[model samples]
Target: MLRNIPPLLSPDLLYSLRAMGHGDEIVIADANFPGSSIGPTCIRADGSTASEVLQAVLTVMPLDSFVPDPALTMQVVGDAEAIPEAVTDFQRIIDQVADNPARVQSLERFAFYERAADAFTIVQTGERRLYGNIILKKGVIV
Candidate 1:
């Protein structure tokens, strides 16, 4: 109900994004992701697609520019060379919002899970698309 605030962002998710400091990472997980078990703080964003959640989050959150690749997506297992359709949508969203959008990097499935485990928070979306998981690093507003 807040004006200008993306309705897709739950209060908890908004707070988490605001509270995160530069370099802190947040995971936008798909329905299959075990966010509750792995994330330090998990926010439920059910009923929404990961692409929708990503676009909403990017409206307020800035992508980390200090790192070479601040946007990271989970690589398809058994087909590391393949790029999931969801990831392509993610990149398109990033390219639209980020001032200097960095190319999305692909992480091996296990590596992505390991990295998600260390994220500041994880937003579990309702996206049913396989390989919908992605991680984004926070950048200073400057």
Candidate 2:
């Protein structure tokens, strides 16, 4: 067990995060996400919820300050204005960890999937909530 690292971050997840350079994006996907089929390298956090995984990741990883929105969540289908409970939880976690907490951006379902497919890596979590998926852009350690 590492001293300061969140236990939820497995060795593989840590490695993936470390290997990712500035601007590379990672997807924190819900259980329903088609992680393997979408194509990016996938990591499994099978027993944990998306919120739990996000909190653990934000504890060590820095969010991109260069972008207006480094954090994004999948918008509820047919209701772009709708904010699900998971998104709220994700926003709260981001606000707590990031120095400049940017407003969470919303992406259309298919758009989100396309982005996730192009992500540097996708971490699949056990979160059961609808629209629980989120994407995070990695930043420099400065």
TM-score of 1: 0.97
TM-score result, candidate 2 = 0.97
lDDT by candidate, in order shown: 0.92, 0.92
Kindly list the per-residue Cα lDDT of model 2 for residues 46-138, writing each as its tens digit: 999999999998888889999988998998988999999999999998999866577899899999999889999999999999999999999
Off by over 4 Å in 2: none
After superposition, the stretches of candidate 1 with alpha carbons farther than 4 Å from their true spots are none
Deviation in angstroms for 1 in model 2? 1.6
TM-score of each: 0.97, 0.97
Q: lDDT tens string, model 1, 84-142? A: 99999999999997766889999999999999999999999999999999999999897
The candidate scoring highest on TM-score is 2
What's the residue-level lDDT of 90 in candidate 1?
Answer: 91
Model 2: residue 111 alpha-carbon error in angstroms:
0.6
